[model samples]
Target: MTRPPLLEIQDLRTYFYSRAKEAFIRSVDGVSLAIAPGETLGVVGESGSGKSVTALSILGLVGGNPGVITGAVHFAGGNGASGPRNLLADLERYVSLTKHDGRIVAVAKDEPGWRAHVERALARVRGKQIAMIFQNPKSSLNPFVTVGQQISEAVRLHTGVTHASEAKERALGWLERVRMDSPRLRFDQYPDGLSGGMCQRAMIAMALASEPSLLIADEPTTGLDATIQSRIVALLAELKSEFGVTTLLITHDIRVVSRLADTVAVMYGATVMEHGPARDVLAPGVEPKHPYTSALLASLPSTQTNGRRHAVDGRLPVIRGEVVDTMNVPRGCRFHARCDRITDAIRARCMGEEPALATVAAGHRMRCHLHPGEARGG
Candidate 1:
């Protein structure tokens, strides 16, 4: 049986005003995704494809004028809650918009009022119910405090281990759990004392110390050495198996997604192009895939050999054309400008109107005119 989604995002839109451009940068435009209980959903895309922005929007962390204009992030609490709570409840009351030719031209937002409401709504939920591990471990960590103390603070705050001695013990236990070498020595060390890999391990330990029901790992393996990245991935794999914590992993690395995610969402031009089970969506030479997904998979440096992947000889295939610009997204398919598979039959439709995310196969969805007959709402 299919389980109810633990985190459901419906038509989320996050925009940032650019004074020089005299317009809003649609960082995350009309994105919808869901993660079931104990499932890890990996969102993969290019650098400017809005992967990180979607993660930030989910936690209500987007900043700037008129941010998060519309959306619903429904999170099902793990503490015996009756149903999923809409984190963006009553959002329309604080913002007004002016539309010109069916496009947003101006926005008036009560920033102060909205901020206060968000804080109130997420007071008991942000760190306790959902924890996030940001990309930069050193920058995210407190520079002035010892790593162990920082983790102990989180343990005390969320896990009810109030006593200093007990909290410290629990913090040490987490350090050991993350496989930190010389746990005692590392406990007293500050952020600067640890290597990039070790700091990442510490960050992971701190995030899991709270035992949050949902973990959002945004580019967790980024900015690390290749060897360190593999180790971090391995550790995360182990932790996922041990804890069974539901996760939303955002990254540009297909390898990381292949290793960690049970399901995948491919984002482009600030929107999802395809979403489905990892095995099907990431499979090489797979049919019925969106042009964007096929291009991404084709760009990989490895090829299948004897049922295993190995490095190839020649230069990797490159997807022609630049990534879509979000400031002025195209009217039709977001990837139409760069798509290589547009046929004569679908050319007009692919250029005239945006295609909805339609079912192409069981448990698989794609947004392209090629699958017009299966059109359905995202």
Candidate 2:
């Protein structure tokens, strides 16, 4: 029997009330993704393109009572697509705690059990099943706590290791696994005591302490020096290979994706315009149908300083008005506002009609009126 996907997310939307704009932000507007076990999926996008929010939404992290998240996020237990291991079915069971006015909203209908379930899921997502190594280790890690304690705390909660001693041992072992020599000494050191690379390694070690099946690393190597960044990404690749773990590598670095991703998903605005095999997504002309993807390929800085660096034209085109509201995202193509293709006559239609995602190739999906397939038939 075939097993279920390691993790599958379908049309996931996460909206947040924007205090600055007084409108809900389409942070994780509509996203669908699937990953096989042991595959590294690279999510590439600009800073505000909703990559991090999508990751947080997956673990139900974004703090909001009425914070609506509508979609499915499923995880498999070393099972292929045919298996019954679906996180969506038991999705609420994996989501973090939700309390409105001190009243628990959903989770088995009971107040206490609901709270317990919420706590458990929070502990699980932040605990075992999924681990997130954030972009900034300094802010994420506590200065007072020893690196070992932080990791040990997670391991102790997620696993059945009752004794603190066992948790510490496991945590130290993880530190060693991340290739931190003399882990025992480093484990007792505070976050501030370690160098940037060591701190990053400690963070990774902490994140993996629970042996999570899925690791969501958000720009894990950003902010670090080039040499350190290279080492960090290498460390993660090694871990992924050795443990047979699935990873969601979130970054805007095309080069990083080239190095680590087995599959690359390009995020433009709140939608995924194009995606496919890692190499295919990076391929020139014949492959990428979206102008955005083509632009991204073109925008990549060339190795040799062939004249002054030139960025994509037109200031990244900030949608020329206000960011679209999640509550009222325009009908057709979400990218049409900033899109240069749609003509004046049909621009209204492109802005008004909703375009569902369609496959142009065997495993590739794109939602655009520009596809030749749509032009030929209809």
Candidate 3:
């Protein structure tokens, strides 16, 4: 029997208001995604492609004046007993069991009723539902404090361990669990002193101290050597298995996606260009419908391609002319300005008529004007 998904994010839109244009920045546009319980869903895209923003939106984290976010991120918490059940059986019961991670920071825009949902969603992730490890550990960790204290803070918040000493012991155990050598001593070390790999490990430990149900890692291996990157990834994979934690991995590396993702969402600019089981979405097979997906895969370095990397034709189209406004959106596909595979009519549709998400196969979907029939069939 198929297991029910842990989280389903539908029609998420996060726009940032700016004086640069008449509209908001439209950083996240509209995106839909889902992650099954215990499954790793990888989100891949270039910098500024709204990959992390999508993750942020799921947690209701976007903030500040001139920002508008509207979406529903529903969670069917993992059955307390562990294995799977049909989510439809008692979705409300499952939802009632959810807990949000509170420690993850959010940048929220001022909007009506935003505070209530933000607080409610965060309550789930703060210590129970989700935790996040960002791309840059150097900036993420505090230089002045020892790593153990930071972890201890999270442990205390989530677990409410009243005694400082007990928190210390648990924090030490977390370091050891992350495979830090001399964990007890390492606990005394500040973020500035740890090696790149160790800093990431510390960040990972801090994130998991609350025993979160889900983990969102945003390029946690960035700025590290390949070997170090592997170690961090391996460490995250280990913790996920050990704790049965669901993970949402965000990175631009297809190889990383192949390594960690069961399902993949390929995003461009601010929209999901292609999504499916990782293999199918990453396949170089014929009949790949999205031109951008094909181009990304082709661009991967391959010795079989005679050492000549395939460059997607044309430069990445800048939102064009100047930074785009987010307060008000232009009519049509947010991607129309940059898409290469679009027919003239499609381009016309893309520019004037926004397309909704369409399913091409079970568990696979794309958003384009060209696939409306499939949307109905799916």
Best by lDDT: 1
- What is the C-alpha lDDT profile of model 2 across 10-64, one tens digit per residue? 8776666566644557677678887777888899877777888888877756665
List model 3 lDDT by residue over 128-217, tens digit each. 557888887877899999999999998888877868999999999899899988998889988888888888888888888888778888
Tell me, what's the RMSD of every candidate? 2.5, 6.2, 7.5
TM-scores for candidates 1 onward, in order: 0.94, 0.79, 0.78
Tens digits of per-residue lDDT, candidate 1, 271-348, equal 999988887788544442678887787676654532322225766767789999899888899998889899888888
**Number of the candidate with higher lDDT, 2 or 3:** 2
Worst 10 residues of 1 by lDDT: 303-312
CA deviation > 4 Å runs, candidate 1: 284-288, 303-313, 373-378
Off by over 4 Å in 2: 1-3, 20-22, 78-117, 120-125, 163-166, 283-287, 304-331, 341-349, 372-378
Report lDDT (CA) for all predictions. 0.87, 0.71, 0.70
In candidate 2, residue 245 scores what lDDT?
76
Which portions of model 3 show Cα errors greater than 4 Å? 78-113, 283-288, 303-332, 336-338, 343-352, 369-378
Residue pairs with clashing backbones, model 1: none
